[model samples]
Target: MSGAVQAKGGSRHGDPNRLGHGEVPASERGPASKRIVVSYGFWIFLLSDFVMFSGFFAAYAVLVGNTAGGPSGRELFDLPLVAAETAFLLLSSFSCGMAGIAAAARNAFWFQVAMAVTALLGAAFLALELYEFVHLIGEGAGPDRSAFLSAFFALVGCHGLHVVLGLLWLTTMMAQVWAKGFREDILRRITCSALFWHALDIIWVALFTIVYLLGSGAGA
Candidate 1:
């Protein structure tokens, strides 16, 4: 009779959340881990960006030849200048990877250094792009000049705008890291930024190939 009561008490008073001495039931546990939540949600955001860019790509493709008798990409694009810009952006991506590694190791100094390098390279790429735009506008190849130019500016300019936003984000992340060490949330933020920067790098590479190299070949 005593054993039966003790068993009954154990059943009633023991961890009600557990299942046969196993881990607690997931339903009773808290929300999903922050890593899964952040990464998964951010991937959705990136996919939406990809969709937007894909639309721009399609528009550019259709309108590429519809220059309204104006200059084509081959005549206007400076491959040398674009190659330099590509180098800077590619280097920035490498630096961003280094920064991510530093963040994982929780090395504040290296993280800052890598992030600074990334910012500098990204800025250089942006500066070059701005210069190219200014030169093109001065040459009367502005977006208003032709449908082709308009599409060109829209596609390339959109990417430049992203880079500008990324720079701002990078600055903010640096400030956060300085104010607070490599906290979990901050590291997640850094990871997202790195992903964003890498995405830009990839888009730029495609831009270089299609809009620069191929376009230049066509006009030549």
Candidate 2:
């Protein structure tokens, strides 16, 4: 009631700077545009994802040394394979960037090509990670073998699941682009997906360092 009265009184008083008096209309400075809203919302989603990963990382840190008379990371991990996975994911990030560039320039052929490259690289990374997991489980170092392995699988498997989702998103994006051309909403989605793909790269780098490099060092 008071807010409405204030607006009414302000209008009656001819206040030059008041909102209802309309030096500048409220509509002119109203809600953010769709692109701004979508981008902002997607970043909030990414931050929440990071927070979830942080919890996983902390749990892994606490349990990293709790191997129950089982093989440690150094004994179980294959660094060469992990290194290859890292290479593939990093290259996917680069290719994703190229796809974004092509999208911005509205180059259909290059965008499709770059997106395909990104998808292939991302799939290759996932393949290597899956093989590593299967090999470890075959070697009797499965998650149930020890607390350390449990934490490792939880953190790394969560990341792998996200990669799978990202690949599905990329496939949808390519389909959307092909069907719709460079529509504004589609471009916004492409930008958000690129950001997401790059974020996975960053997380993998940290995972590689903490779970592989430092974890192995601890075994020494």
Candidate 3:
């Protein structure tokens, strides 16, 4: 009697809507899971990036005042221009956020518009940075001039390189979205880009506060 009842219960439990322990339900095996996994993996990558930046920051801090009779940050830094660069980057981060929102809503037009604005702002920031570098080099404050100059170039140039890569990534994402219509893979890439841009914004804030504001004697 007990054996017969157990067999009947097992048969009733084998509904198509249910799955065994080792089996993956359709909902659990789809794009939702993929998105979660991609986000997790990308976050790990971002953390590693943060670690690298932290090391750069430590080195810069140690070498910031080693001017060796060369121009110091107080003499070389144009606070107003740096403020403008910060404004542009912050605004670009905002536009990037809007782009991500538009992507999530599947509004291609707004997404494109927001991304274009972001790219433009990012370009403006990079242009200003390049101008600063040119002016410094022309003033004979090249990286080879002193330990301070070398550290400054290393720290800030690394950040600038990241911005350049970010701009390229932004354009590629735009093209991918245009071509693929925000498919899960493309959307994941967009999400990762957005995260990266925001992370850069945060890093810039720290850089500006430490290297610009304090070094300029403003925060100091």
Candidate 4:
């Protein structure tokens, strides 16, 4: 009887030192269980965000020719400036990638530096973009003056808003890293941020090509 009791106890508490025994596989865990809600949520947010851009593209398609005797893309768009903006955004994306690599390696200092660099680049892009908008508006080419300008402002401004939001997110994540160290949750958040930043870069490339290159051709 004593031996049977001991045997049962051993089976019931087998390997008390074992971690996550008889639990769900890591990959099979739900988003909540794995603390991946932010990762999954960010992707959904991106998709919904893209829908807004799609609407803007449709509007631009309809209003591309409505120059209203002010100025068209060929007259207003400085391709070199737009190209510089593209390069800044692209570099930011690259920095974000480096941040992810640092996060994965658990190097907190390098990760923060990379994130800071990305934020600076994003800020520079926003500055250039706002300057272009202000310059255009100053020259009697405000959005309200023409359907084409209105569509252009709406599309581009929305993208700029996203960049601003992304910068805020990056700032928050940096703080989180500083407070919590490079835990798995923080690393996942950083990874999601990287994905989001890169997505913006890709969207900007498309926007640059369609709004700048194609618009210039149409105006010419």
Candidate 5:
């Protein structure tokens, strides 16, 4: 009878939620460790990227009015073109989120479709930005034209470069999904991609508001 009571007490003490001496909860053990580590590391990377962007934002804010007698943002910025670029990027982020959902559900067809749409939207955004840059340079308002132009190019071009990199990353993820299916590793990569794409949309929104809208005298 005493042994039976002791066994019952031990069982209760070993409850999955109960962490005794040197015991780990099931929620924090095994495969969960890998997922937690990967996500935490990725978040650190994103935070570092944000810090870099902060420096660019500060530089642009300081130099925006130093146009050296060249055409100002009010004269050069095309609101309609910028609005289109913003739309494409924002929509791509939505589709990328859908792709992540499809990946989690292991729906290969929907995942591929959503990813394809996202890639196309991202490409369209890059194309529009390239056109804007070409038009500016053709008008002799290139980065070398003035301090304001230099800061504008540095900020916007940095973002454009990131978009190009994101497109490449998206293409790689598609290839990985096609080859590996919705395995754990593939899903993790998809999650990271979703986070990255959404972060870019947020940054672009800030850029649009501060650099484009305000610079164009919309808020002035």
Candidate 6:
């Protein structure tokens, strides 16, 4: 009887069903570690991307005046169109934020919808940008015609490439969510992509201000 009692006592003291001392349950581990890893990885990527943009910016600063006495920023830039493009991109960032909120809430349907809306807004912004480029080129202002035009095209085109790549990344994330049903990995990737997209939008705002606004007044 004493042995059986001791066994019972041991079971209570060393309960297999209980959490071990100073141990965390898997569910309670939280996403902090994952967030840190992801944030670090994204920062590295952003740094690399910024390096590429810096090269383009330097090239533009050097060649912005080789306009061959042709149209310059003041003559080419339509402030109204640029303003509209900025609005679309800013709104797209807002939509991406909404999608992130939905993902955090585990609301799959709303997350998909928000992502779709963000993509549409991004597409609209791209369309406007492409139209601006084409219009400039059509007026004998092609990049090959002048160093100024080449630099302008290269800087703006590189930015547009990023936008296009971001849209592709966004689309892939949406598809992954549909296939995986909000798995932790998918959510993390989506969060990273959202950060990247929003960062691009912010960078574009600065570029637009510098290239179109300040540069427009350079030779005036």
Give the TM-scores of the predictions, in the order they appear. Answer: 0.87, 0.88, 0.85, 0.83, 0.88, 0.82
Q: Candidate 2 vs candidate 4: which has greater TM-score?
A: 2
Per-model RMSD to reference: 4.9, 6.0, 4.5, 6.1, 3.3, 7.0
Clashes of 6: 0
Off by over 4 Å in 3: 1-32, 218-220
Cα lDDT of model 1 by residue, 1-220, tens digit: 9999998878767867655644556677789898999999999999999889888889999999988888898899899999999999999999999999999999999999999999999999999999999999999889999888998999999999999999899889999999999998998999999999999998999988989999999945
- Point out where model 2 deviates above 4 Å: 1-28
Greater TM-score among 1 and 6 belongs to 1
TM accuracy, model 4: 0.83
Ranking by TM-score: 5, 2, 1, 3, 4, 6
Residue pairs whose backbone atoms clash in candidate 1? none
lDDT of 4 by residue, 122-200 (tens): 9999999999999999999999989999999999998999899899999999999999998887777777777778888
State the number of backbone clashes in model 1.
Answer: 0
In model 5, which runs have C-alpha deviations exceeding 4 angstroms?
Answer: 1-32, 218-220
RMSD score of candidate 4 (Å)? 6.1
Task: Report how far residue 22 has shifted in candidate 6, in Å.
Answer: 10
Relative to the true structure, how large is the alpha-carbon lDDT of every model? Answer: 0.92, 0.92, 0.92, 0.88, 0.91, 0.89
Off by over 4 Å in 4: 1-32, 35-38
Cα lDDT, model 6, residue 40:
92
| Candidate 3 residue-wise lDDT at 47 | 99
